[model samples]
Target: MTREPRSGCPIASTLDIVGDRWTLVILRDLLNGKSRFSQFLSSPERITTNILTDRLVAMESAGLVTKSPYQARPQRFEYKLTRRGEALLPILQEMCLWANAHIPGTWTPPVSFMARKPE
Candidate 1:
């Protein structure tokens, strides 16, 4: 697969992979320990199946996530963030903190959860 340009600027490069609204939400859900396909669907954001499928596929192609079949027969897939994907924890945490501080009625995440070192 052809890789997209990710170095027009450092931030641009980072955004190129995880910049879209849904992409970040996906990452956030994963960081919160949601791994299964249905779990992602059940997020409060209520993402549609088609969009979720597309985003998950894109993320997999971008090396941010991996899909493994955990069931036989019809086959069921579970999504897991790769080490590269986990690297975005700091970015997600910063954004979440900023939103909670500046946005009206933003719910605060657990301080301990945010303080934990990224795996």
Candidate 2:
């Protein structure tokens, strides 16, 4: 699915790349320090292998994450967030706060994560 924005609005442009369920979940996992493919696979939401692969490729293309080979034999990789991706931290933090206040059963984000800055 091409994510070309329909207009030049900043929100619209960002949504073009991240307007999906899995992408932000993947971003959340990255922010929480999960890097390897298996680590992402272990999330409670239980993302499937195919979807994970596709999202990782999309994120790589969007310049949100970079993949580096950890194993040369089978070509395993670890995904690290780029500065662009790190810049989403505050947005995620605000979203978490909103969810905790308005959404029942939502847990508070960790203090460390709440206190963290992108830099």
CA lDDT scores, all candidates in order:
0.87, 0.93
**lDDT of candidate 2 at residue 10, scale 0 to 100:** 94
Evaluate residue 89 in candidate 1 and report its C-alpha lDDT on the 0 to 100 scale: 89
RMSD for each model, in Å, please?
1.5, 1.3
For TM-score, the strongest prediction is 2
- The ten-residue window of minimal lDDT in model 1 covers 1-10
- Steric clash pairs (candidate 1): none
TM-score for each model? 0.91, 0.95
Off by over 4 Å in 1: none
Best by lDDT: 2
- For model 2, state the Cα shift of residue 60 in Å: 0.6
Per-residue alpha-carbon lDDT of candidate 2 for residues 32-58, written as tens digits (9 for 90 to 100): 999999999999999999999999999
Across residues 63-84, which tens digit of lDDT does each residue of candidate 1 receive? 9999999999889898998999
Give the local distance difference test score of model 1: 0.87
